[model samples]
Target: VAVSVSATASHPIPSTLWGQMFEDISSGDGGLYAELLQNRAFQQVTPNTTAALNAWHPVNGATLSVVADTVPVSSALPNSLQVVIPAGKTGPVGVGNEGYWGIKVTAGSTYTASFHYRFPTASAFKGSITVGLQTAIGHSLVSTPVPITAASTAWAQVNVTLRPTASASSTANNFTITLDGAAASGQTVHFALFSLFPPTFKNRPNGMRVDIATTLAEMGPSFFRLPGGNNLVSETVAQRWQWNATVGPLLSRPGRVGDWGYINTDGLGLMDYLNWCEDVGMEAIMAVWSGFALGGTSVAEASLGPYIQQAIDQINFVIGDPAKSSAAALRASLGHAAPFPLTYVEVGNEDFFASSTYTYRWHDFVTALQAEFPNIHFIATSNTFNPILSPNPLQYDVHVYQTPTWFAQNSFFYDGFERNATTYFEGEYAAISTNSSDIFGSPATGRLTFPTMQSSSGEAAFMTGLERNADIVFSASYAPLLNHVANSQWTPNLVSFDAGAVYPSTSYYVQKLFSLNRGDEYLPSTLPNPTGTLFWSVVRKTSTRQIIIKISNTVGTAAPVTFVLPFRTVASTGTAQVYLFPFTTVHDFDVWIPNRC
Candidate 1:
């Protein structure tokens, strides 16, 4: 580490340096995940019984049972829940679903609830159905009753408009559907494929959860790394995220078992993600499903052609000329006629885990996708193994998950590294605290994690390294961005929320502050001692002509330091507002409240 306090000059830094990562991992209702109904299509399976109904409970004298679909219907789910209101049953008897924990309903807002149903008999069943929101104890509010004069004997969809009263509580409400006058001695109605959604982000059908999307939009991310982390390539080859399986009609999408021990609705499909990016003013950094699976299974070279072509088609659908290719035409039919802009295409996620065959696999994908989509740049998983054999990648994805002390100590990890044509993307990195109560906190039962000062200080220190080497590190994003408190798969997420409120972690603020103040050019600065206790980066904004100095002090006591900008004249009025994040105890990292800082 060399330092010359006299030489304080500025150089160039890339503007595309910081962004966010969003994945489907126990994202709360009305949070990042859009699907309100947990087991919407009833695609549940367990050891005890095949069709396992997890989140749903019987309501008002109704008996719930999962039955296999005897007859196959076009694009219908395999299993359906049978609600039996006994012949002598009194009052409204039906089923209720506690959405992803609980349904979030706003006062005076209309929610669209729909379900598919069919009768056991061939005769047209005459009945009435009421769908609405209610407390867990059966106190009802805002019920929409629809008369079913004669529904089809085959699978038919029913939709109802529900508007909660102005006084209805927005939290801890459940979405329920009740059937009346349909309980006959020999008569029974079958129901399946239930769905309930609030007004989405842009009021688009099958859209994003509004509140979650707004949160990400506020962060002002440069790009959205869509579809997932290990989720892109699951443990099983059958469960890998297939773009084709996740598009178009909802019923047609056969949701696969997610890598994180749950089912993915794919309700937030590729088009939906692109629309979200459009709404948030970010580009798409799409990750294609490479032939490698996390379970250490790589598709043999002879049969890897289809997967490579799928990646090409995904690119074609996004950026290729619509008039020329069927893939692009399909994109047009999906309502995004004009191709969305995408600069980086990641071949696979964490493929370096299988380094034995990764280079060859990378070659296969790069050779096919790069030749066709010459305009788009490609990124590899990691450079841990062999240097990329052929068709060099533009950037390499690097991931680091370590303790806060490790991150703070390694703040200068990339200092004076060889400058090469290939840049770096820290796609998934976090100062994890798996053993601390701030993060793990009774890991056996706890599902949500909070960011502590120890963790955040480490993250800030590491980010200063990225800021210092912005020319080499083109972009970076924190991993597992949003976590639903009830059913999270990963810990130390950026944001955690239940049905009621959102808690942005300490690290979230660190990332937000960095993102909001990303300077255009790097400035050289010399420290007096250059100790590990302090980490900082100096850069200048090309647009504002502001000299920004981001400093992170990890030590216990603060030391007064003075700066001398020799090359430029200093003005007292040029000082901008100082943003300081004071340190707090690790135990107090539970959540963020207004004015807590």
Candidate 2:
């Protein structure tokens, strides 16, 4: 059944049509080995099989709602956008809603809009902001407007840059967010959010510029399962993702309306995604959707105790001990009082589409959050996996979007489950094609790829079969990490990068070459000859026998690799560290090339 046919992997110049598919390779525990180096780089930003709906401003809030329709609406603000008079929203109820906010744009793509303002610093205060090109249905495709003025009233910010002009078209299905409040009315100014940015896709920011620690060091992510998949749930229960209306000072944080049709701009909440996983090092795995929901709704089991006290106040505001109270005064008003190591939370996300996450309104919020955090670590995305929906020891969190050779022929479907020390969390997998529509609400259509890389090297050959089954795959990422490449609802994404520059994919160098060439230990032995498209995997370092090769060809063509020395007396003595991720190339987020003996 290798007889298959596919058409539109589309190519005219997808950076010079891919390359070499396969050749020589042998080694599975046979002491896995490969000594071929041909340009290797690394990066991160792959995850969006379904979960980042309206994933803007980090995850939920900081700013992003700039718009303009005009009429007393500060003449439709835009000089890259800037307007601040917020001493107190006044004069006609802050000029009713205002207008102008449809940012879908994407003609050559490279936008970066902004907004945030405040006035009255007296002899040292100034203000201004304006950006143009509207007219999808409203107006102002530049009837002249592009002012952003402000030195500092305190807020300060009004960046604007647009290149849209190849006759400029395709707003990629028109969108809107426009906002304006009649210039300094009653001179009490107070409009805090505003944004617009496209073409950063997956690295995040569709309607609000992003910079989160240089997009998490080119997404060299380690683990960030937080609020992932279904964006951590909230289609109902009166629209969730609250976390105190999404944190401070950006209009005192009050932005939610999102299941991802648009309007999230919470600038990403929960202490700005745990200080954005401590500025890009990553490791937050914070899911808490429990209490059941995809849409089936459940709090039963005699009111699953306020959904297990909102999962113990979202783990005492992420790792407790902010000092105690009001979640440690909202973590000292978001400047961080510390406390954010979080082992794992993950209560719900896929909630079994509707089977209800592990039962009883999600196993009583994971048995009252492991009975009040008894050493953390609790997960459960469920739709299938069931430890009887666990009531105690947790960790399941699976999810798939399918395709790419059925994810390289089932990549050994969990080797054979039943590990009972129970563990695994691929969380949200991908490939998504066949039209991919079904994202929770079900109807089905995805097969993955909202960004690009021939479907992220078939999701880097199923993350090289989840790093040849890391123990049993303890953690994994790649689920709606982001999407804004032209209002992209979802598609191939794994580090498209922005701001300065970034680009990774050959499926994010298959976990940046298996998380910087891992090898804690795993070497049974015996493998060689599955050469359909080279899929090597082995690890050994019991002190230092060295040896850790992880190759995944994904059959694009060029792979004349050669290796077979499990240790016939260590000849060709140590040393070899290849990390190739080519198929025309863009992979340079990690890029490491070292091979000598």
Candidate 3:
């Protein structure tokens, strides 16, 4: 609790509190006010999850599979594979709703298809498992069906060998591996941990595709957040993002249940995400499946080894070299014969829901990860846990979702936080909705419209809170970026784009504009809550020594404040670049003007 001090007759107001609010600062209240300026007294959250598949470098891809057995609600997994080998039926194992299936290859090229599987009983079918790769003529073939004869019950493995057709070596080929009649026989067929490759993606080898390659290049985004929301963990630890189950060939491994409301294609495995990030020049921030999943389930202290080891393997795959170890050998087969650089390893996402559950994991992962790689920084999902100062160093990841006015009103929310050396990460803070504004409207509307964009005044006030104390906030970013309006569980992404196009919302420009224009160092100034009808803030860039005044008029009127510069330090004088938000608006492409979906 903070010691309170109020406006009393003896309350000494310093003649000039620029150096320090010395007169009032000495009182505990001054220190309380100082808390606002500290970076953060706890952990820091960065952004969203980013993971992909690389036929070359298979890490978590081998342990997990994002399957799609139904209509994709979001970026769930690939579409379900259909049998019957109809002449033109085998298209893609279909991920992202993109019809590109597994890779097509050359004749005599030794290829392996490995996938994870869990059958209730091996005796149930006692038959060969069916798997296929679609052909160029739009026809599907069940060419690589491996026989599952001698195997244990429950969690099991299946592998199939296939030599590429005379067609091509690097072109796209559709590969689909499915448990033949397990499900039909009323047998529970579970698939997780699967993959397929020719010993070459990781440890630094080539693994990329022209189609996906094209999509990524166009986004031209500076960062890539993967693993996405909910997919990292399920309603329980049983549903955690298992990284080891996703590598190897497409057979042997069976894909698992996906939290994205469907089975995952596992198509976009761990290595895939990293490769995507690498291909797109995105710095990967690997977020471990924080203990808390959607519903109520997490890793108990006794059963965390698998979880902990998975973290180690994830780090190893990202930084390990190519050689003979099981993991390294797998990488060689995938396509990558090299290592991808890893800097940040986040422990969880939005664990505020399960502070008790996440606290243990967050604390454990931080210590273990830090001890293994001293150079790496750990980001925790909870803002209350700071591994750095708690006999250990940790950053509290912060996230806020609110209306622009709420943001404007809470601009000073961090003011009373602690002043420890511990830091913070503004991992995710964006206004969003999973719905497109089309509401039951026709298909002619554009994209969905949410109240995401607002005047710079609110941003300025918020950014000032950050800049005045940049020491705490190491970095920050908005979440649910790149939402395909047609299907999104989370809406109003930072930068929305499609196969052939990209659109930067007003919020995107706001981030680009402020973050780029800010000065080297920040000088502080104060704003009294005048009229209590506006949000105001100012920051003095150290290098340029220019003070940027940001004011947001929430009272439906231009509530202006007198401009004052201590040394007349205003850069170009009175008028400044002003940004505004409208009383009404929507974000839809011209063609879908009213569709809003």
Candidate 4:
């Protein structure tokens, strides 16, 4: 492509255009979600050491029995595990928790372990309890003991600090708590709502995983679209992502069937996402549950009033007056007294498939949200019935998942969008390289396409078009920010990880480059006889007086290019920096590469 520059600024790009999307599918608490213990509340049934003991196992030849909570912590979670130690047979009797896959520990690092426990009747013996990080076979890595000298009928929480002298960076470890004493036959101690966490992102209680949060912050995203993809509304309306079901105490959160084919321990719920935004200094773009399920079922138009009202209540809960109602007060009780800074509340996700009912549902939600949040902006999904009635003018979500060829061909796709008709949010998009087809399902069968150099280059080219059309495009973000290699539900995620390590994909670098170098204004440049495969965009940062030029060579071979400056007089000693990505073939993707590599 031949390029020429002139002293003309065509359009000023919105600084908020480039951001990130975090869904809950592949990233549960065990993945990117910060809750350390998997099935901590024993809500998700798993085949393990005990019934309903998904990741927990009994230690020292003791049989741990799972039962309905005689002393319930909350109505949300009603199951608890009971450990029965006979009078003379056991060295130590308790449960070991397999956190996520395994609890990752660094040498000499401190972790917090806590759990709620109660004795059935008054225990005849005062058994001292020990809790720490350990291996599956009962090798303690970070052991600490806290004596339970007195038996209590009421449920009480015990806390302990553990510092491991050895490095279990393998992330293949567990949290074990054992009662090391003799007890009368059938004397039982019940355990409920156990948790073990490494150092958090901001050191807040019930906080986020530091590694995952740090990776996101480094991307310099301006906004975060939260509560996820198809997981926003599950296969059934009964299991949708509801803010009320996932707040306050961790034990109280009733886990649900994940839309992505597992269990969703809603440990990182509404407040967690909001607090993460505050921690990373990004704006919140909350996606509420629309009245439709992924199973091709939607609520009737007349029945949408309650869902709309719920949406309003959710907004109130986020930016509501705390003294106004009980729900608003509950938000304050969750530790965020001042209202969160929320501007965008998406009505439904991917309502385009709803066909005839989508328009009415969109209309119902827009009408209700506008009545309550007069100043707030609402984004319409791609399947909007009529964008003309939208509260936020022309704000419609545009999602694209395609191959490199498609991305290169559609460089001018958004240019033709009727300027005054509809504004756009490139909410979810990625280039699916044909080389690697690994996703979230069977290891033999691929899920989402893995990120490759070919794909990243294609995405970069597509982003150029997005930048060129910023006048109509309001904001854009990449989809499915995380994937756990062991149990992923989707692939080609921006970042991938296992129990031990987290790494960004080739596409992640492209996103980081564009986001970090975001400019203040778009400059008008021309490609005379532009080639089909080469894509480029030019912008100027008015504050720094620097012109940023981004170019993508999507073709297999390299092509020579030149830039002509718009300035009358150019600096002789000016510093110049160019970013060039190496060509990666489709077959080059390996999920286990280190993040920094």
What is the number of backbone collisions in each predicted candidate, taken in the order shown?
0, 81, 116, 4
Highest TM-score against the true fold, candidate: 4
Candidate 3 lDDT over residue span 64-174, tens digit each: 223343322112223221122112222222211112212435465545565545443455455555554444443543366566642454445566666655645333444
CA RMSD, predictions in order = 5.1, 21.0, 16.2, 5.4
Model 1 / residue 554 / CA error / Å: 1.7
* Model 2 C-alpha lDDT per residue in residues 267-307, reported as the tens digit of each score: 45666556645655566777776665445565567766765
**Which ranges of candidate 1 are over 4 A from the true structure?**
1-11, 28-30, 44-51, 71-73, 167-170, 181-186, 385-388, 434-448, 527-531, 567-571, 574-597
By lDDT, highest first, what's the ranking? 4, 1, 3, 2
User: What stretches of model 4 exceed 4 Å from their correct place?
Assistant: 44-51, 86-88, 181-186, 384-393, 433-449, 528-531, 573-597
TM-score, every prediction:
0.90, 0.31, 0.55, 0.91
Local distance difference test values of all predictions, in order = 0.74, 0.46, 0.47, 0.76
Model 2 regions lying over 4 Å from their true place = 1-191, 197-225, 228-252, 255-286, 289-345, 348-364, 368-390, 394-418, 421-423, 426-475, 478-496, 500-502, 505-507, 511-597
Q: Is 2 or 4 the stronger prediction by lDDT?
A: 4
- Candidate No. with top lDDT: 4
Tens digits of per-residue lDDT, candidate 4, 436-522, equal 443224425533356877777788888898899998887888877888878766667898887777878888888988898888788
Clashes of 3: 116
